[model samples]
Target: MEFHLVSLILAFKKDTVGIPLAEISYFWGQMGAGKTSIARLINYCLGGSIELSPALQNEFVSAKLTVRLKKGPLEIERGRDSNTVVVKWGEKEDAIQASIPARDANGELIPGTGIENLSDLLFWMSALVPPRVRKSKTKADSETKRLSMRNLLWYCYLDQDEIDSSFFYLDSRDPFSRLASLDVVRYVTGYHDEHILDLEAQLDSLRGERMAMLASIESLARVLRDVGVESEPEIHARVSRLRETADAIFREISQQRNASVSERTTVHALDGLTAQAQALNVRISGLDDAISEVLHARDRDTRHLHEIETLSIKFRRSQSARAVLAGVQFHSCPRCAQILPERPKDNCIVCGQAEIDDIPDSTEEALLQRDIKQRSEELKEIIRRHDAAIIQLRREREELDIKKRRVERERNEASARFDSAYLSSMLNKERERSALQQQADSLAAMARFPQILDSQRQKVGAIQAQEAKLRGKLKDAREAAEKDATNINTLGQLFLDCLVRSEVPGITSSDTVEIPTNSYLPEIHSPGIADNTVVSFATLSSGGKKTLFKCCFAVAMHRLATKVGAPLPGMLIIDSPMKNISERENREQFEGFYNMIYELKANELSATQFILIDKEYTAPVEELDLSLFSRHMKPNDPSKPLDPETAPLIPYYLGN
Candidate 1:
């Protein structure tokens, strides 16, 4: 992608200033002349956060940025006090207003009020597919991961404070930011593309799945505690014991049935046995009714418990939202733009609704908290009731089972004693055996729960193995990418060449320059220095050397981008490159730096635009090619400084 800044327009209350950009536009002015402000305005209009001076803040109403992208030209306008931006695409007169709010209001972004965000439109217009980078090297699946044009701006722009800093290339001091900076360089150098991006996405998804499965395993452990199994190994051991118990119970039932059959010949009256059976059946039917009632009560309590839990969650959320709203202080009416009048501490600013006589701020938050507490207590009570109901249901079922067993024993005794009809007694014994067989089957089924848990554990383990494999593949891919010797050598040579051309003290073409494969940062080793002694951008003694090294490294990266056909933004803005260098003492060195930049733009890297903001040109303008510099505001023209008269001022209104 080729990105060039055409102009930056600062709209004042009464007048507007349009700053035209060129291949190398120099905004040379004294300190506090609004030179740096212009650079910051360009950044601000491009979706950056900035703190403007009071003078600029009061004078400027809005800012507009015009850039010529590969697709077409785009005009982006942003007001000082509003979050909305007006984006005009191509030559179309119809501009689309997009919101890019700093914070969400009313569940929507106030700035990006529409479906498309400023980033989306910008990336689309640039014809560049935004790639995803890891937020941290330690955690590839961090949800905070994002890579956009705004992040890329750190590489393209250098403010007055950052031009000579050791970590100027980085956006922040955090380790994650340093890694992200390296990734940005890698991306712009064509070392990363959709392939790396896809791999990262896949790794993220796999990690998510692995985490979810691990969570499920934890939940399963909690649930299985009710069945007395605490872990997978425990479940396996319990399954073995339960299977043996089930087998022993089945054998015992068979033995008892066989013993009852042998004693069937001891005679008794069939009429008496029939009367006893009828009485037993009536008792069993009553027990069945009682068990059914207990089951119904348990189901009702369970439903009530679910409802209470849901209500508790909702009440908690409502209480939190109310507390947040209660602390919000309104200074003005958003709809009417009226300044809110100061009221009593307990009175509402918008509606003038008085608070409770003895309460603070408002009673709403306290009331909501009370409601949440009440709901929490009710939920606990419902849970207690549900648990008690379950215990009662279990007791009833156990008692019913005992009664049924007793009736079966009585039936066996009666059949063995009453042998007047032998065939009928045999048939009755067969029916009793069938009922006992079903009860044994039910017990066996209950015993199989451990096996089911074991199966689930196996499934979770399989997924974990797959996740590990995917992680390995991702790691290998990253390592292979970092080991690209060709890119490292190419970038290293370009960096060294730029440093030599800039005439940086103690650096030459023959000096050992190494671009660390991991960080992609340049390191210089002088000829007479120890093998372990490596000089980096931070180790340089002179501020001018640091600034030159920073600029040269940046230019080298862009030059490499062009060579590799990477989608570089094709623009670089540097502020105060010669802040510490004296024009009288280092005039020759300054001239060399300027000439190097001119030659780079005029010959090799013509597509890339460079904006340099400094105090003044050290060399003659004609010698450096007058066409190379486009002059804007110069605060130190004839050694003049900004004073009260020249600074932006607001008019006072007279009383009527």
Candidate 2:
């Protein structure tokens, strides 16, 4: 997979800036000259989060990135205030809206939003398949790890802050960043694929099953021990003893059954006694039920009568209070302490009007009294009905009780005459025999205990065998991974070669140089250096050395990918690589960096695109062909403000 940046358009409110990209383009200027902003805008258009400067925010409305993928060209546009990206395929006006840190089903931001997400879309355009990597080395599962284009971008972009650091790839202090860095390296180096990931997932599942089987076997053994059947021999012995005891009981029951048939003449008498006893039991149950019903009714009627009596008392008190108030005459207003005019004795005092004696009306007190009288009569009727019902139910219950007692006496006499004592003894013996038979059957079921144990052992054996087979497969996978180490080593050697060509101090070909297989980081160990020396991108002291090392390493990886036909996006944008270098001290090393890049253009890396952003032109830049120099903006060039006026405008596509 290969992707080349064709151009970038930064559209401002009043103006726009268009930057045409080449194989080796440089945005060289002084500090705060907006050199880094160009690189940031490119990244922003590619679905990166951006914190725009006040100037850029006020000037730029949106940024657009145009790239030529293997399939065709694509244009991605993004506004300054939003993370949404609008992508347009070649010659297609229909824009696709997408964003980064996509929301999941629960509407929470998670990596790899969906098919329309910028990361996945870019991957699709690049023809690169996303690979799986362990989220953590300690927990390796299919569902736990993921490698998206967003994570891969960490390697492709180097901001000014990180260009001189020894740990160039350490974008943040997050644990996931470190893991993702390793995974991205593994993926781009052609060391991981779907088949490897599938094998890992299967191994994880198999291990889980094996553990469960072991736990089950342990639990079964414990249960067997609690039942006094710890071993096969003990189980067999118990079974034999139970069988003998059951057989002896059965023989006794058979003899008793045979002897009981001789007493068939008494069965008729026994049946008559049983019928009499059953009739008495039924009569007693019905009498008890009737008594209960009558008692419940009496209780309910008593509560209702009490309520009626209370209501009657309350009404009588209310009438008494009203009569007393009606007799009193007011001489003055109590509230205002004012004298009142005299009135007739039968007049209504509240309304200051004469009472009409002929008016036919019942007062509120009279209505309440009538209601109380009605409720009292109703209560009295309920009491009378309850008392009568109780009396009748008691009479009926007494008669049934008398009949039941007489029938019971007769039933007992008949049972004695029929010799029920002998029949009862036989029935008890039969029940005991049935219980013993059941116990024997239960013991006999344990005869297969040895087979069960054997089955468990076979299961464990099978799991172990499967584990061994998977181990062999894993070993083969490791071997294949080792074989792929050559590609990384080749890149590492190229890195060392570039450093030597750039004349970096204390760096030589004899130095042990290689990209650590685990970290996928370039490590160099010079002679006489301490055994514990930290030799990594972060530990490089000289700024020029660090920048040169990072550039060389990136170029080496690009070359290796092309050589091995690996899926790389085929574009690298380095920002401000001249931060720590002075022309007087490191002119040769600075020139060597660009010279190496220029040399690779004539070789297999010719198709690769490199965007270099720095503060000034080095020796190599002066010697390089003028056509290779893309865009150079001065600090305050009136003719070429960071936001140019003649650049093409970003269309209002997808409402962005």
Candidate 3:
């Protein structure tokens, strides 16, 4: 299989946007007519999953990306909610799923009319996460958190328009990127390995935060002993005195304090119902808080805006000479009708006075794009905050209402069957406990609490030792953390230095993604990067680089289709490959690229469609075009034509 018409743009070092693909197909246009825009569309259609805004910005991204061939019905992950999956193949047909899995009564994933291979890509695209929550931290408490990722592939393209490596040509012995050769001649034969000395430094930072929690428990225990609860010599008389005082208070309450006789059930019910009502009120309050937060912010902003508008209008009107005098009576010809001196300078138009107390002003398009953008963000943030609050309020309110009703019923049942004098007796008991507490306070001066006996003191000492050990551990963790931070900083610097040295690998580097790193886990560099002898088109001779770019692009498309795991649709479209270099080099490089594609097919990693924009360079290539495409044209310089009939020689089709 083959591919045709795939274009993509990669960012270049300078802030210049060009059509890396357009130059080949564009024989008659001026330099830099934004040919990379096609690259953006091609990437999008290829299922790169680029954000709409950024994808649209490709033309302005200083990357001369081209879209020469689109190869698959590439499967992609939908929005941030990773469970959902979306697949795009051409401009027709769309599908959506609540999730990739649905279980039957047997707890087995049910067979469904869902996408194929899409699940694998989706899982990988989502980094293969828990499908359901295993902890309270999960959004769904009972949700299954399982991830499966396998059989994933991705496409890669070369934007060789930005090459940095020095390579050897037949005439030039130096190498830029041998991989640039369309003919599969050892592009990247050797490999490099990045040392992991940097990764060890990162592990120390996580150990330090665990130590702080241990220190808090120790301080709490110390405070527990300071409140007259420590062990000491006992004062038995003080205890006797406290007992006597409680007895005396009990007698006094028995005679004087009489709580009205109320059934126990009724009291319980009333208290429970009251609690429920209070909870409901709390829920309502929370809702009100959320609404108020948004409202208050909106109102504050509106008021500020009004004040500004008023002030701006006044300033503008005063500054405008016509505005200041609209209210004043002025003759058509001031000098012709009256005084040599018209109205006195600085005099108000309405009255012959310089001072004007207030003036109204109007504004148009005052809220510029920036202001609108900010307000929109503010509004969205408030809405998001409010949604969480509203959910919490509803949950609390529902629970409160349910509990309140149960308590109310219990109270009513108890009230109808009164428990009589038990209520009075309970009051006497409460007074007795209070009197005992007061006497105990005085006795506490002796500091003879049994809870703080010598045995208990020993136990407390052991706790203190344990706490100290935890502290020591925590200190070690902190040291580790600091060391790790230092390593990370060093790694960051090294990474930047490497990028600078590589010179961003030409505009093509954007197509080359910086493999993602996991901060929470041990850093794992890409095998390609760790083995630094990597392949790039830059090492190719100028002619070879262009051919290598096309080849890499083809390989990338093939990879993306396979990675998506979905059956690909349509065919690859290429507009005149092998047009950027001399005929000899172009033929040699094209031949090499074909050999590689043939090898991939032999390995059963191939299924593709090809469309080429050939300029009728030679019969070997021209005949290939004729065999593939019904529409073939004779080549001529579009800039300068040979015959009058062939005035418009170049059919500017595939936006080079």
Candidate 4:
């Protein structure tokens, strides 16, 4: 987005140093020339950390970097050891000042911009929407984090210390930073564009909602099971059976009411009610027995499930231990203190059996875990069923007790009445019929549960279908992102070209360089004498090679970003491109590297700004741009001292 460094001003206690930047700025001198400090100060002014040398800690008062952003010239200034930076933008007359803190939680406000921190302010100035990414890779619904200025600077600046030690923080020890670094690469390459971000957000939300729905269904099924029904069909069937039994009872009661009953008939009716009451008591006792039995079974299954969980944990620990000790070869038994016999190949060291006979520990562990999972699920199902049975049995017992109470009340009323026996029998039968009708009404209410469960199932099914459709769309969109493929391909080829031009040892034109999409890191595939071998940045042998390798890839990325109009800054600040290399021994390789850089600048990157700090200078030819600024600082050569106007970065202090 065209972030060009115009100037850097370092204010000291005694004097201020103003260094003007150009299309290509080279600063090279002795070890303590303070060249690196210039780059660090520029980074510090732009909201980055600085490792202050003694000179800076003592005499350096503040540092300021003026840059030409897309909007206009911007000034960012930071005082030594300060936690905040001051940014001034707009015209020289009515420029706005923003007191930006390192963190937003510190609560400094940026004027005329609706941004909380420096990162957002930069993005706002660029007139680009800040991109959001998931904070965690493992969680689909993790909070989204916005890409910051520091992320973009990873590509723009290659510091001296990390030039050889790190590759864009891709292998950072801190997990969050590592992920952010990967996201930056993805963003630059168009893999993490706004469209993909939106689709991913939608997918995460839908997946979370769908999980909740499935959990609700499981809970609802358990509730239905407690009422002696597993499905809609089962619920309907049971309801129908209960209603039919109640209807039969009603018919018997109706017949008794219409029958002409003599004294003998009254005695028979009384005996029949007594008999019904006794039968209810017996049935209630049976229900109690069933409930108790099911409770015991449920408790037993719960204990078994607990045991399985414990064993599963122990099994996993054992597998881990085995994996850790698999490479060890013992000379003597630890317990017996006896020299061990020579073991045959493919044989167990402990058991002295063929390894083939003893199942692979990983395979065994997998099978054990699977078996434990299966058994645990089975136990859970059994316990759930037992609980349901217990609930149903208790409910039946309660209903029978109510019926027995009513029967006894009817018999007592009949005995106390002085009315005719036939009238007493008819009145008792009518009360019995009313009780049966009430029982039938209760059954009708129970039928509604099945309908409720059916509605919930429909909702879950619909959500699942929607989830499938969204997943398919996401997959298709990811596969169809042609821009990402083109950018990656271009970056890889550029990296290879840089490597070949620099004459990096052990690599030839035939050796293919690839930036794998999965890791977003470079890989070198070389055809070996016997088999193909793959090498990465970490495996590059010499420190000089590693440094050049990283710098080359960064240059290639900058070129690609410029070509595609990506949102990377237009300036590159490299501290030490030859920190470990010896120009006297490798003149051809040394000159070739700078030659490639000069060729690109003269042609494709004429507008880009380059700031390089090294111990040796590689002067650009006069045929190249005349705006090249090169500074050589020597410590005044105390043996043959000359002018006091050498203009060392901090002239008063010479400490490294």
Candidate 5:
């Protein structure tokens, strides 16, 4: 399905700066849908001539595109009084304009470029184009060639009024100066000579300012701390004498306390006793459970055997006789569709005793009574034997349970004896451990005395603290000096300047860069125009600074596209390039700006596709005429039929 064949989502994708390609994709929808917004996004993606606010994010990543250009032979002056045509491989890269010879089928050059239609001309030029190279081809004049021209593929912007009325013109304050003047893909892409230099200069300025600010902060902090700290040696000597006297007194008191205390070994005996008790508990539980289970099983089996025995007596007393009922197997079943196979010789195969030839009725009661008597006798005998066996089994189970209980009782007595013996031995071991612990404690006390030499410790601590403080002060001073040059304020100002230049009128970023900061320059102003000016989205003009942002974005993208080969996958998003252009003249100027979006950088791609978002105007927006997307706008829909009301606007009748 065509992406735009259905619903028209008025919204476009958003980005901080540059016409976002994602935003423009929705541009081709019906009237009231954003079509021109898409164009602006394309322009931005290609890094066209728009100026992005410095405040807006400008990230540089690679892009790719298929080659498409106006096919034409370049006209270059040949021999004296003659001209020729030649094919040049590279697009306008470094140099926006170039002159080349126009050539025919033969090697002989032509007088002027013969092709007209740009799209078709591009194809022809592509065919004749040569490999890109830095050096220019030398003419065979025999005299060493003096003058030669070379062509370059461009990812930059150019500023020309007739070329494209840009977003820069909409601003009243003119936040961007060099930017407003910038009007080409070459200029925006940084391919222009001044771009890289400007970036470097700004970065340098920021670094310098940052350092200066840091130094100033450090100087103030250092000057504030006036404490005259004492030397480590003097403080350490006084503290050491006091600590030595305290330690001697503490040792004497601890020794006296130790001599008076005695150790207890009873806890060990208690632990051993507990373990022995737990072992016996497990044995007692298992034996008791096993005995109960055996008794229950024996009782249940015996009861069942008794009941069956009673039934056996009734079966033995009953009489028995052969019983049969007669029925014929029909070849075809009347009730169902099924057919039965032929039966054996008997008339009724189901009951052999009866015949279908003379259908037998019910069986004799006497016969059934006789058969019951015989069955009852057999049942009684079987029951008698089963009952006897069950009784024997129960007797055995009871005997086994009694034996198990006796064994468990004996085991418990043995466990109690073992517990007492283990307890005695555990007490002896505990006493030994206490004795060893006392010896180790005596040795440890002596070892700690040397380690606790108070004089040395006090001296070390004092010196370390003094050294730390001095080092801290020195570090602060050095850092302050470095920071003075590269302070946050300095960097902020530089970044702000860049942003201020990139700012589109009314498009104040939720993002802000604090600038006008400097130790020397205390009265640094805010980086941007007043907050009052940065109003609602509705207040901002579409094709103004916001739209210009896309052009600059395109220039950047073009550079990246050339680096790689083929069509670019990255999308360009433009909200509304013509958002601000409501009046006819302004709209047309923006449309021209739209054309300006597709310059050298755009030409490198397989196709510079764009999504255009357009707002339907009450009048026939003449400014929109300059844009290529104007062709895509559809006539009024079936629902919104054109009639006497909308007729004056359309050149021809489009509705009933």
Candidate 6:
């Protein structure tokens, strides 16, 4: 993906300074002239924390950087000592701006980007899927975390201080950073491809499912043991015996009812009691339906009221946003990256047309507020009425229940008056039948436990089968990727070539650098020195040699990315590359380093953009398409003090 900076704007308390960048820009100046400070400001705007000098801390107001991505131009603005960056994207008239927290994102999605933070937004704008690596390397089934933009920046941005002190953070004291650095190497080298990542995600999910199923099986077994049902067959036999006894009791009760019919002399009285009970039952059912209707109406009204309340809240928030953002104007078309023209008085700042008031009138706002209030009040009143109706219906139903019981008692009394002995026998038989039927029902319910257990076992077997198939597929995908060893070898060869051109001491074209897929660190083998003795970045003692060594590798990485269409941003920023190396003593090495960098920009990396900050300027013989911006800044030295106008960055303060 292409990423190039258009300009860096520093808003100081005294005045604002705009530094325009080109395809190749150079910021060279005297000591303490804020040459390195320019790079630090850019990094800070992009979500890096740097120790600001006292001069800047007191005078600086804010920093803004406009960057052109593949999609369009995005402007990022960060205030002094602020943790959030305000990003403006999209077109001029239809622009969108959101505040994104740099740190402590806590997995929040930025509005309109569908991404969690600035890092994810950058990857999304570049049309690249953020790569994922295992959080814990020791566990194969560990969850994965995304390799963020900050991780990739380790390769792109080389600070003035860290250039000689750090080697791509590979030797970082923090274990997480060290591991992430290794993963970044693996990613750009093509070892962590998309297909392999997808397979890993699938396998992780399957492992979770398998573990859950195993837990469920253990829990079900424990429950069965507690109930004394040792086996499914034993429970089935017990249920069968209970059913047989219940059937015999049912038959005996049926014979007793048949014999009692002849002794029932109060048949007419019994019929009257049945009719009255039927009337009461119908009245109770009517009351139940009335209560249900009232409840349904109340529930529907309550939902409507909730929706209106939510709408009212959103409306108020919208008004607040308008008031806060009033009179904000855009100076550039974010989509096309063009300067905006001045509009007529009272014209729309966005479209440069006549202003059309979109804010609601006071009368309309009042009407809306009144409508919401009235609707809420009406709903409350309806709900109160429904509650009263429900209570009334329940009271009526209770009265009918009393009448129903009285009819039953009267029928029983009339039967006893006719034949007390027969009634007593029938009542005893009915009670016995009820007890037997209840036992049968309970046994039938328990019989379902064995069936449920069998179903659960089947589910577990199915999941295991699926898991086995997925694991096989994942293994095959990984094996296929590991067999293709071309990417890592190519990267290693590029690193060696860059080292030769940069002219690091004790390194030549004959040396070989090996970056194995397992550990993505360069192991140099120089035949002129010691072929058997492996020389790596850690073995390099000279600070100058280390700075050039790290820079050379970074250039080679960008070159490789350009050739293979890797997802590295098309920009590089190097600050104080010659901090430890003096140009007068190391002329050959210094010139060779700049020569190599310019040649790459002119040829293989022609599309790449570079920002170099140093004490001196080096130009190539050949003229490039886009003129390189070389700004020389002078500090306000007290002895032969320079004017504030000479200082291009921060001019007012004296402290470094």
Best candidate per TM-score, number?
A: 4
**Clash count per candidate:** 5, 3, 65, 0, 114, 0
lDDT of 5 at 533: 46
The lDDT of each candidate is 0.68, 0.68, 0.37, 0.78, 0.35, 0.78
TM-score of model 2 relative to the true fold?
Answer: 0.55
* Candidate 2 local distance difference test against the native: 0.68
How do the residues 261-359 of candidate 2 rate in per-residue lDDT, one tens digit apiece?
664333443464467568867876886787788778778877887887887788677656666766787677656767776666776665568875653
Candidate 5 local lDDT, residue 183: 20
Candidate 4 versus the native: TM-score? 0.66
Residue-level lDDT of model 3, residues 1-656, one tens digit each, is: 12333333333223322222211232222223222333333433333333323323332222211222233323332332123233433435543222332111123232442223433333333332212112222221121222211111111322223212212221123222121221111111101001111221221222222233334434433443333223343445556677777777676556544544342322333354356557766776775676667556656655665665566567556558656656666654454565333567677533456866454344433444345556656755665665545455555555455545554554565456654444533443454467577657666654534443444456545644654554455445434544444333333333333332222223322223221122111122234355554334433445534444434444443443443332222233343344464446345544544444434333334345333333433322432222222222333354654443322212221223
The C-alpha stretches of model 5 lying farther than 4 A from their native spots are 1-423, 426-543, 560-570, 599-602, 606-608, 615-656
Regions more than 4 Å wrong, model 2: 90-116, 140-144, 170-173, 197-475, 528-535, 618-627, 637-656
Error of 1 at 124 (Å): 3.2
* Candidate 1, 458-494: lDDT as tens digits: 8767766776776677677766777666776888888
What's the lDDT of the predicted structure labeled candidate 6? 0.78
Give the runs in model 3 whose Cα sits over 4 Å from its true position.
1-42, 49-543, 546-580, 584-586, 595-656
lDDT of 1 at 417: 67
TM-score, candidate number 3: 0.27
Q: Tens digit of lDDT per residue, candidate 4, span 263-355?
A: 234554566667888888888888888888888888888998999899889877876777787788877886897888888888777667887
Alpha-carbon error at 87 in model 5, in Å? 44
TM-score of 6: 0.64
By TM-score: ranked, best first: 4, 6, 1, 2, 3, 5
Q: How far in Å is the alpha carbon of 125 misplaced in model 2?
A: 1.6
Q: For candidate 2, what's the RMSD?
A: 25.7
